[model samples]
Target: MDRNLELMLKEQKTAFYIFDSAVLKKRIMHLRTRLPERLELCYAVKANPFITKEIENETERFEICSPGEYEICKALGIDSRKMVISGIYKTPEVIEGLVSDKDFCGIFTAESVRQYRLLCELSEKYGRKLKVLPRLTNDSQFGIDPEELENIIRERDSHPMIEIIGVQFFSGTQKTSLKKFRRELEMLDSFLEKLKSEFSFEAGELEYGTGFPVSYFRNESLDEDALLEGFSELINGLGFKGRIILEIGRSIAASCGKYYTHIVDIKSNKGINYALIDGGMHHLVYYGQQMAMKQPFLSVIGKDSIIPDKLWTVCGSLCSMNDIVVKQLPLPEIEVGDVLCFENAGAYCMTEGISLLLSRDLPAVYIIKENGELYRVRRTFETLALNMPKYERMD
Candidate 1:
């Protein structure tokens, strides 16, 4: 814990997100060091948009799937050239801009033949060749049919503006099963073999979304090195020329951030103790893993921390009963004005949470540079309803 950071936390008037750039750099670098040279790494903007120049330099590209995400990258001044779009719905208007942008030079995922045709139309109109990766799924989710993909490959001569890189498959997210992902890779190998033998697909990139977690909790950390090493073994000597592209979201950013809010009230109902804070569930991140466990690394600031035998449930200020940060947590005695700091919150917390449900002010982000310099990058934003015309009542 940095003393300067503690001072800033105590001085803050509202809830805030604090990110340590040094931690983020270490996390990303640790993974990158073990990856093969042929691997291309991308950071998912939905995880966190606080992309420092150091992070920007480390990342090969970004995966953005929405216009709002595009706006976030634009606001952060991240290069649009390094972004690849992959979403269920690829609107013509958005795709047109992404392809025509002078800086745009990355691949885009076409999940269907309809989308492929749209890309062809746009590329021909713009006089450009669009690089594309066919999204593969089992028909329960977003992906082009395998037969549809093959038909397009067969008719490759018809669409010169679009270049088929390779098929992209997302096995599962937050999956720790090595056997499952290995099987997925093996399946992909066979798929690539058929494409290569029959359709002549070569040097196409496999956009693999790495769905591993960096921080489940402080006690249980995933052995990323071993997992990635296993991935290296699975892909080794598969006879595929295309590079493996990994899109990492929460793992790279989560450990670097901590969420803080001062306790406003303390009460007990029946046998359960509750500590209510100004910041509620809406302002905090709700990771599926963390939510399932109902336990994340939490620090009580401003005191030496006494270990009293009691369980405390931290609740947000929202009136909804579901507005809870932690259902039950064993902690020392906590009181009003004491800060509750949620650890491993650098990713998915603020940006992905339902900040608009109660219309609470969006939490501001304060960044501590890798050099230990601290400053605010973004201020809290008021709700959209607050700024809307109050004179006319629609309801």
Candidate 2:
């Protein structure tokens, strides 16, 4: 840790996550400079809504996935024109509210025929015009089938309040195969051409989820720059003359965050070393990791030395045997108060963890601003209240 960060963390006595806003902006700027300029960058707010305010101006649009995400963007005062409401399970109340509000000018994506129908009904009832993108499924429950999407396009003229602006598609994440991406793009291009030929429908935009891979394990070797280069080449070569939007989340936010936990106990069980940490599976999360079989990016902050001189199995405060952080990690002579720093934890780790399992206290969150000021966003919060119900009379 740097001296400035260490000074700030010295005052924090509990496990926490620290995010660097400068790093976040640098990552976004890197993508903007490397990728095709014609492609618009859409930051998926589901990844890390905490940093949305810091990145709102840097991205062309924000992909809101849920009511909470929308509320976060709205609270940040992000322009509605720079929002794309995209998700599989958009609630009726939320959609109705967005459509009824005359000031809400964001675009909406239809994941299913039911969603399309709901949008049509709400738009007609509220007398508000809506721009929609019908998502095509990649053999998943996330989007509408190609045939069903065609039917919607055919009947679009009947619903004058709804306009089919483009198509939305997203494959799974942790994509390492460039060939697979190219194939998907080719299929999408062909699909757009078919729509143009059959119904004279020209898509004004195409919102695609890149699902870029993040290297969480030490063994995983990924050439991200090469992949982005090839991805941009493929997108630029596409014959579609519509606005192309790349919805990304993990790759942009992962590098800006780090998780910190301190050891509370150390013991030797049956010739095996064990170090108990304050945080566990409920706080630290990494995609595509199983039982700590692979080593993640971690470092030990010790008083004397930061070198690794011993192998220890780190466990969380949870009572379950499955609450292991790492199987066997190389570490220096660690004491009870030594801290462990886990890197690349800025993405889904905050929200995806099984936090309410044992009703453990959620860690504090801090952000280092671009001007080199450390600010605490959230203090250590107790989750037992969320797990327990309020006292009420039995009816």
Candidate 3:
């Protein structure tokens, strides 16, 4: 066994884990520097709040999708002016609560007249004009149709409570075609031009919703320069002085984290080997389903003579039959108590996990640094207890 690999396996005993924040910061800074004037990167809160404090300190703005996220931002002392609130279905309480607060400058993304009316009423009651953007559907499953979007603007403009600021469009996540994006941009330009000519209304901001690809998936690369150039050209063509905002969640946090689990048992079924680990669907569901094109790469720890011939299906300790980590992956020799590390488990894994079959506690989260210093950022037990709704309690 290699000494360094053994040390790495020893490090996997802890529950939840993360990569160095300093390294993450350097990556974010590089992205910011590359697209300085052309883009305003708003860190999406859905990724992971462990990095929120660091992000708030480093970046200028962020995106909030729910009241809970809004509260998280407030807790982090992020200025409300630098936040953009966006979601498809927003509750009345959230609209009223956020609008009534004078300190919060929120942008509501409306897809229907009902939501528009609701926002208008909230703004009227609060005695403050609420800024909003019509979420336009551009041949996509989500968002409002282009004609319906125009109608929404026209109908809502008469209301003194709502201030129509701009337009928003989200194609989808993990979009692979730049050509498709170009067509969408062209559609947006045509719509904006038509709106400006007919209604004499200029847009305040052109928000391109985020779906930028990350490197967690295999054979995927985001051409930073090409993307920036395309965005700059699109903005220039629009001829709007409004800001360009991007809501990035996954791409920013995926690479800077990993999930570490120990091999609890090894078995052979029908001439096929299987390595059962202590963690699986409860911690890393994305890996189980290969969501977002994520195919995990495994590395054996503490073993020098580990052969790369045996194929093993990585299963979880949970009793559920579908609780699998990796299906028939070719890997080195493994035994009970051997540790296996899965790269790029950061974005939605920890936050979206559920302990359904068993009451096993959530993992402990740690941020590992470039110089090998580890910082215990967040513990799962308390968070689980707090986030669990009171209605869910039987006692």
Candidate 4:
């Protein structure tokens, strides 16, 4: 039975694995090694908590988006003084809680004067000065209008309680264009200069929001050397004395992990074959969403001669029709109980998994090192079943 299961796993691609911290640390170290002395790297905690320790140990600072993430960092014993909070909507309680902590210095991504004033009041009540960075969106889906941003900054400057420390701009997720980034930076620089000259308000800092493209969906021909050079040029041109912060999430984690599953069934009709794995969209939703554009290829694990020659649709064992890893791919001949592996599952997969049905157990996670050492970082059944609420029958 065990041998059969092993063979079945080999036939079906199935495994959800984490990027080993050692590997991720090396990648981050490589990036930081080349970064300018004035620039600060802040790893976005929204990506994965598995690397939080590694990040704290390596980088100078970190970014948080939610209350849960902030609490996680606190629990992990990360230095809260080096953390920055950013989100579209922040509750009064959350703002109060963060501001009260002396170690916590936050930046609320405000869109209006009301938000700015409220945050100021909360900071005053907490007896702590909060650093604010206005979220700038330049003709993009996620940012406020350029004119609206300028207005908000001007309004915030009038209030003695609010301090406009810097400006932040996010171009959107998975963006891979140096030209677009350059344009956004230029717009921000011009606006900042105008604000400085007219209102005599010093734009203390600049934050380029996370959109650094990684190797998950598709690899673009981004010249790393040129990209950094362009970034340096922008910073130099701005001539702002404040520090520069990068909130990067995906680019740091995507290339380091893989999702694995075991094939449960197989079907063939009219020269077309289907391999169904134990896990699907529930485990990795982004893979399914991007299948139409960037289909994942299958490869046999621990087999020397096996190679993919025919295209097959890799589906999950879920009831949903859309639960698929790769809709079509030239895969090797697979059999029942084979293990299927999906690459680039590190970012936004485990952390963002949602239990749609709540019936299937969450997939287990493991980390494999360069020396072939495997560590079970988290278990599927244990974490999934813990704290499930029970309902009482009413008469």
Give per-residue CA lDDT, model 4, range 317-345, as digits (tens): 67887776776666677777666666677
Q: What is the lDDT, from 0 to 100, of the residue 163 in candidate 1?
A: 86
lDDT per residue (tens digit) for residues 316-393 in model 1: 888787777776777777778888888888877887777777678887788888778888887877887864656866
lDDT of 2 by residue, 1-395 (tens): 68656875687777899899999999988988889989888999999888888987898999999998999899989999999998899999988999989999999999999999999999889998899999999998899999999999888899999989999999989999999999999999999999999988999999999999999989788988999999989988899989999999999999999999989999999988999999998898899889877788998775435567888999999888999988888888888988889999999998898999889999998888999988888889999999998999999
Error of 4 at 49 (Å): 2.4
Ranking by TM-score: 2, 1, 3, 4
Q: Name model 4 segments beyond 4 Å from true.
A: 1-14, 33-37, 103-108, 139-161, 217-232, 287-293, 368-375, 382-395
- Give the winner by lDDT: 2
* Candidate 1 vs 2: which has more TM-score: 2
Ranking by lDDT: 2, 1, 3, 4
State the local distance difference test value for candidate 1.
0.78
Runs in model 1 deviating more than 4 A are 1-3, 52-54, 218-222, 289-293, 384-395
Model 4 has a clash total of 22
- Among residues 3 or more apart in sequence or in different chains, the pairs in candidate 1 whose N, CA or C atoms overlap within 3 Å are 280-316, 285-349
lDDT of 3 at 117: 79
Q: In model 2, which range of ten residues has the least summed lDDT?
A: 300-309
